[model samples]
Target chain A: MTNRILYVLALSAGLAVGPAAAETPVTIGMITTLSTKAGYLGEDIRDGFQLAIDQGGGKLGGVPVELVVDDDGRKPEKGKQIAERFIKHDKVKILTGIVFSNVAMAVVPKVVREGVFYISPNAGPSRLAGKGCDENYFNVAWQNDNLHEVVGQYVNDKGFKNVYLLAPNYPAGKDALAGFKRFYKGKIAGEVYTKLGQSDYAAELATLRAAKPDAVFFFLPGGMGINFLKQYAQAGLNETIPVFGPAFSFDERLLKAVGGAAVGVRNGSQWSHDLDNPANKAFVDAFRKVYDRTPTLYASQGYDAAHLIGSALAATGGSLSDMDAFRAALERADFDSVRGKFRFGPNHHPIQDLYIREVIETPEGTITNRIEAKVFTDHADAYASECQM
Target chain B: MLLILEQLMNGLQLGVMLFLMSAGLTLVFGIMQVINLAHGSFYMVGAYTAATVTQLTGSFLLGLLAALPAAAAVGMLVEAVVLRRLYSRDHLDQVLATFGLILFFNELTRMIWGRQPLFMDVPDWLSGTVELFPGAPYPSYRLAVIGMGILVAVFLYLLFTRTRLGMQIRAGASNREMIAALGVNIRFLYTLVFGLGAMLAGLAGVMAGPILAVEAGMGEEILILTFVVIVIGGIGSIRGALIAALLVGMVDTLGRVFLPGLFRLFLPVAEADGIGASLASMSVYILMAAILVWRPRGLFPAQI
Candidate 1:
């Protein structure tokens, strides 16, 4: 058939270009949600990964790397289809860049079984951190609950005894509240789980006003966060009480949308734009120059994923053969991570410090987070001990 | 009691916005016999135009002014180009074509505005909260919205009842062939009607730009609700739209606020929260179904 001939021709064309280059061509396939309400998050991750590859002079470990990007459509089934294609057709050994955990959980198990390595740029579902963790799976981002748990410690340390809790009614949302409750030694006056993407927060805000908590902790991400924060400020609640959240809520991308309303809000993250590190400075600078916008924590994760894979490829000489050698190389994590000094824990998730960042109106006339203090240092997930792998 | 009062105002504000949207959709469907699924595209277009104009001029009022004509022009242009041909086509064809327009508009807006949602500042005069009661303070902007919705509704009522164009539109809806046979300039009438409908949607979008996140695909989210409003209000009745929008708004807001508490009385907190939320989400559709079961043509059938 003509279709089969054309497919063979394209495959051979890709093969023909490899040998002419200095080294064997490496292909990495990126599958992430690129079209929906949360589409911007995936775009940020993809741009960050692309920026790292561009910085590497279009090579990973001194070899030309061909990156294939596919949109998951924010569906787990679509992610599975893309994963199967990347594994079986493209024959990519390294796979990364999943923005949502539910999609990652669906795709990771299937691809890992097929002997592909997945370095998650974002979304660390709990199941992948504990006994379900695989050697082939590495999460460059913090576990889903890590930052919220740190915020819990921060809230308790600030001596807030009464707090109102809110999150979307979903798995990550529950994990976020659970993480916040883990370390906060305070009475929750009220806990509300709003429908995901529920824009009008008037009813909930009115309820929160009635509860009259000293502070409020919410885990509404993306546009939901934008809507909530805007309404919060409009209601004059921001002036009376502090709002606490993870970095996802108060990130640079969202702060731009939420404007001055986001200023003075405190959030926790493993990476801050003001981190005093050479790699971070370079990544931030290069990202702004290329994208003409400030890169958020999601972008930082993507940049780290690229460098992590690059480090492994360099150690293995652009070859992932001798699976043990490659796994050991990745476990070393010797890359110059934009986050600085990153190393995998027993479950392949990062064992790193969580820093409290406060959104400040910077001298540059933009709102961005500044590193205020460290909440947890050399922190590892509680689930790592349960992972036999 | 104060909470209930404020929640009622919130419901009214939402109902007002939905009426702005549904009034236009019902009108277009009634007069043109064309299901304009791209109605939300007009909303997005209006918001973007307002945001951009506001940014350039630094005047919210001027931005609001520009949104009306800009959205109307865009709507008329679309009517003249794509929708004009599809008017005589089957309902399925019209739906498919208009659905394509939604995608085209969404992507085109993305190309122009980028992925980030645009932020518009409320005019300083409208930014403060007004005391509705001694203990309850409602947002002045939302109060302004309620006022605007009422004014628009009155204006629409007058236009339909008092104006020659309004009579033609009514006649066109009930008997298009007779209007055309009478040399009523049916082409001009359709374009004018669509442009007017588009302007109403634009007005809703402009007002909503400050409150809602003005981004791509926003039109689709609110469009579904608008369809529900029109369906419940009657497919072609303006008065029904106003009443049904208010009803849907109150039911949704109050259900979200009080349902969980009612459930908690019968069950534990967590289980009640889950059950309450699922039911609350279904409350609007259930209302629509109940209304239809009793009156299949909706509350007011727009008697010809």
Candidate 2:
């Protein structure tokens, strides 16, 4: 009778121990633009983040994590809805992976207010880096203007007297031009704000030609950049007036689409696949083996974000009961980044080196960006001073 | 003066492309009395097919040839399978069904081609710029597009006015029941018209592939403009479609070019630029509204 009672007690104890040892995976919600023309942006981020988690055997820093992903479709309202669902319905404490500034702006402010930690793999708007900074917010990506600012500085150094500027009429677009102007003190021949998602540029090109700038600087991301570069080349302006933009337009996949049109064009970036770092080499090789494609800056950002989160999770032993301890751990940012050196400012945005990369045709006859020079070393965002924190 | 000339040429090129897209959409709506939200999907299908074929064969002409038939076949299949069931249904139901088709085709392209935008380079012969005048250089490919648009317009005119199929199509558009009573296979006729419309959209897609990023959902970007063109031209009237497409295209292009400069004369440069860009995007829509107010049945309503 005593043996039977002891066996029942042992079985119940085993059940309790199994549940505790296994532990419910800490949930991380990712709302990203995984559809529309910008879908590839999110695909790279998700793939990179998944790679890190997969490396940890469905865990981050030896802590099991459940990642719930949903498509924002590049819509602000849709992103907000997904964030709400993740926060309330799923009871997720962590959020990440938004590709567009508008969607991030709409979703981040609200979620951070709800006491959920938001790690941005991409899309670091200036406002959030400034007065809107929150303890719960951290950006593994550079601020929206950082890459553009690097190009602006490079253009100024190149002795371009008059440069024409163009970007979509949106917050990020405005920030891009502002960032360029901060460094480029040359004469602005003309400035144009195009409609968001506009594919055609004939009319704009006509005026640009008339303006007679020595060079052109544009920030049309994704498919917009592809159309612009092709048309720019087709118009016979490429040979006369050089073109430059941030790395968003000159990503690996986009360069393939732009072909010879984008060759010789200079773009600013914070990370490259060929960065001379052990961590970067490992990442590039592993990513190519797993995904069978070159990783864009976005993929690098996602990988960094996952590792950053992993560092914090490791320090806290994956426990989030003490918010202060978790926040402090994240602020430490104890991870070896693929970008060579990376750390967060007081605003939780990245303070890192930026590089000027030139599009070149490899011996294999494929177009890709190669680092030409380091533009800035340990550069921080202009808005960092405004963050009281 | 050179800048103005170049801008005008740009406007003409844009108008020609719009005509190609609107002609097919107007025909389907005018004849079948069906609202097809998925008209753009056919454009996407054509582009994807052309891009794939061009990459494989290394010949733009072969890609164009393949895309036309492929798009037509897909359109015919969709019409016979899905659209046929929605013919007698309410306009709302047709809209819903065709909208579903848009999602279907967009996702289908993604599944097949992956998410990356495909490259479609301009044929070597059409890669350079042609000097229209001493100082005005234009892309040869765009010139070819204009020429192609004119050829299609002429061909469509001859097909509709001179061919027996054209008469049958026109009659069917006006009175489907009467045409059926007169021994015409109305269903087959409708299918042919849909195929023709899809082919024209396909042609637009193939031409646009060289200039634009040939990616999934590319159709929807220009689809709204196509709708505006058909609405302004009068539904089902090809002549009106031609005129309206050019008009809308010119307005859109010129507005984008000149509006900010005009506004700068009065307002601050910054405010003027912002307002001008916003206004330029709205110019076609505003023109459509004005046209609707003046001619509620459109510029040329079908009078049989």
Candidate 3:
């Protein structure tokens, strides 16, 4: 009976195959956290990658490209399952789109094992840059701590005598604080680690209030950043002690949530929507025309990843086996990156410029970041030394 | 010295707000014998409702007023349709059903509000900081939350203890079938009680909206704290929930503030900060576990 049922299922599966499967496109599988608190940034990453793909008219080399999206829900094991399905089931030659380090960490290993190339648009984990950097893996984004170190430089440059640093208590959080301390040369008032994705900052706020630091540096991203900023403003400390943070801490999504509170706040970024470059200008115009809102760094990185992969495919004449040719194409890096010229260092991470941005009121009464100064040019990450790769 | 007092006040304020949430959860558990995980969804709904109304009406009072009935209606409808069926089922079924409700509520909220947080203002009357002590001023809005919490505790005590309705509720909690045999219209009672619990949670939401970001998934964070409150206080005991809620809130707030500083004395600042923050984050859960070890059921188990 089981054999008969299996035979029937096999016969039925052939019938379920639609005519749409015959004229197949280049299947590109993108997996990221899309169902939890981090969903907004994940949406930006997905849309940003798709915008580039869409602009290519659903084709990468005159062949239609099919984009498959899977939500990891911020779980590493789940990400691995999705990666397996992408490679084995979906047959995606190049896999991309992971926002968190753990998710990328889980998925990249499996992809490398199968010898399929994985392009990480974000989550530039130190491990991947050094010993973990596979020949097939290339990150269009910089090492995670590069932007944070720039914020650290800005803090020291401003000559704040006493500063307090706060981040969620996690591995990534440790990297952020470590990055800040590397370039900051003054007396450190205090360093704090709070619960990862913690909403309540009252106790920490009370302590910071007591410490009376000149400025507070924080690395709370996504919803955590939104909560921290509102609470900080409500505690009447917004203007009293200036807050220094990175691009991820504030973005188009955050500005809408923050309203007037985000105004005049200085946050560092490698790219802002208001950045005035020829490539950036063209990218911004095209993105706004398409999405009807400003795109964040998540989107920009996603766009860059799509372009990088497309260029690699183009360089190899759309073949997956030419590893040397693909590597050479990626190394030449001859694509229009919205953040300006970014080249992968020896570790396969972008060595790029960082910008310190201040939130300003636009003529249309929307809050947007204005580039204050270029903090780093061809900046290297702190953890590169730790990575022997 | 001054900082200690200020931090204490902050902790107390957070505790009072949490009491509102615990009161609802514990009551639902005590009476209905249903572990409603979606209790936080009601809180999320109430907060979003209050914020949207405030934006539309431009009157904080009106928003608060409309939000009460809106939240109560939503609660009553949910209990009538979904929760009523789960009351007789296993705890696992109840948890699964309510968990599904959480997903539905989160998606519904996102669809309506478009995933951005809505800002509600502290009313003009309660916007300024009050001089609670000499050289120490606390936000008047937070102080109002404390006052409102005390009022809720008093009202719940009167309703559940002194009034005929209170007698019926307690009696029903102890013997649901017996009360129904007495022709008490048990269905009506459950709906009323659930609605009341929802209002309590909604009140907490409205009060907290200005201080916390008013967004979807906001309730899940508070819901975990509310569970700790229920576990510590004794599930189904309103009075237990009140005391436990305040205790958990104060401990959590104080933990976030002082735990790291305590560790700072011994460990390097970086290591201390890291360890301190992690421990502080876990303090309330640790407190709950300790309470469970001492009193397996809870501090004041309503069943016993």
Candidate maximizing DockQ: 2
Report fnat, model 2: 0.86
Note the B-chain TM-score for every model: 0.98, 0.99, 0.98
Residue A15 accuracy (lDDT) in model 2: 73
Off by over 4 Å in 1: A1-22
Query: Per-residue lDDT for A1-389 in model 1, tens only?
Result: 99999999999996786556455578899998788767888898999999888987998767678889999979999999999999889989999989999999899988888889999999899899997899899999988999899899999999999999999888888899999999999999888888877878888888888888999999998888888888888887898889999999888878877888788899999998779889999999999999998898989998888888888888877776568898898999998887776789989999999988999997877878899889898888778988887
Pairs that collide in candidate 3 are: none
Error (Å) of candidate 2 at residue A148 is 1.1
Ten residues in sequence with the least summed lDDT for candidate 3 chain B: B128-137
Tens-digit lDDT string for candidate 2 (A1-389): 99999999989986775546437788889998888878999999999999999989999988899889999999999999999999989989999999998899999999999999999999989889999989899999989899999999999999999999999998789889999999999999999999989999999998998899999999998899999999999999999999999999999999989999999999999999989999999999999999999999999988998999999998988877678899999998999899988888889988899999999999999999999999899999999999976
Q: What is the lDDT of residue B62 in candidate 2?
A: 99
**Regarding DockQ, does 1 or 2 come out ahead?**
2
How would the candidate models be sorted by lDDT, starting from the highest?
A: 2, 1, 3
What fraction of correct interface contacts does each candidate retain?
0.46, 0.86, 0.48
C-alpha-based local distance difference test score of model 3: 0.83
Q: Candidate 1 lDDT, tens digit per residue, B8-122?
A: 9889888999999999999898778899999999999999999999989989899999999999999999999999999889999999999999999998988888888887867
Candidate 2 wrong stretches, greater than 4 Å: A1-23
TM-score of each: 0.95, 0.96, 0.93
Residues A256-321, candidate 3, lDDT per residue (tens digit)?
776666777788788887777787888788889988889988889888888887777667666555
Which candidate do you rate higher for DockQ, 1 or 3? 1
Who wins the lDDT comparison?
A: 2
Off by over 4 Å in 3: A1-24, A61-63, A385-389, B121-125
